[model samples]
Target: MLEKVRYEGAYPTREKADEAVRLVLSGLGRQLTGDERVDLAARLPWEAARGLTAQIPDTRQLTGWAFVKDLAARTNASLATTRWDTGSVFAAVAAHAGPDLLTRILHQLPTGYALLFGRAELTQAA
Candidate 1:
């Protein structure tokens, strides 16, 4: 996981990549619930899974912008950097989740999550 994050984020050190992975996963944990969450945790390595399972989750779900804003505040990082970290970490995660599970996860979250996971959000013309 750290390797993927490091490669995707171009982090200078393993620690930096690890931090990004943990922060992104923890934020996502707050947003994911039910069987999809459990299934994802099961799919990941134990340490990564713990990051996803550890959060208690907020009662109200946050939009993707809000999620990034919250993470930026928590890390004292700039929004651009936080957004990059989220994208890098989620790119790794989306690879792990594959198309099907990722589709389920994106469905559960609010708008903008698909792009966060490195997938486009498409709408059918009416």
Candidate 2:
């Protein structure tokens, strides 16, 4: 999942990024159901996102402008400059599968550093 999800912006340190992950995990744990828990657990090692550093390529060496540009292209979303202090990236995976499909995919996403916003069809990945 981490490999498929493109990351954007300057996370000063891994700890900063991990802080976001921690917040997301706490929120998501409260949103789970019995079936969802079972399905997630069966997927493999439970804390997949925690292993993100190992699985995903590093972007730290890239220039800030280059990093954001690459991520924006990969995710098919523009990086917002006005709201730069907030969430730097604004991404949306369109409905090749429609709203229901996206909802399921999103429900599986870790919530801490990542935020879900906007309408069903045009969901924003911040």
Clashes of each: 0, 3
| Candidate 1 TM-score to native | 0.96
Candidate with best TM-score: 1
Per-residue lDDT value at 116 in model 1: 85
Could you tell me the TM-score of candidate 2?
0.36
Instruction: Put down candidate 2 lDDT per residue, 1-126, tens digits, no spaces.
Output: 222122443556655444434333333333433454344334423453232212333323333344344444544545563123123222212212245543554564433222432333334679
Judging by lDDT against the true structure, name the best candidate: 1
Each prediction's whole-model lDDT (CA) = 0.91, 0.36
Count clashing residue pairs in model 2.
3
For every candidate structure, what is the RMSD over all alpha carbons to the true structure, in angstroms? 1.0, 13.3
Worst 10 residues of 1 by lDDT: 115-124
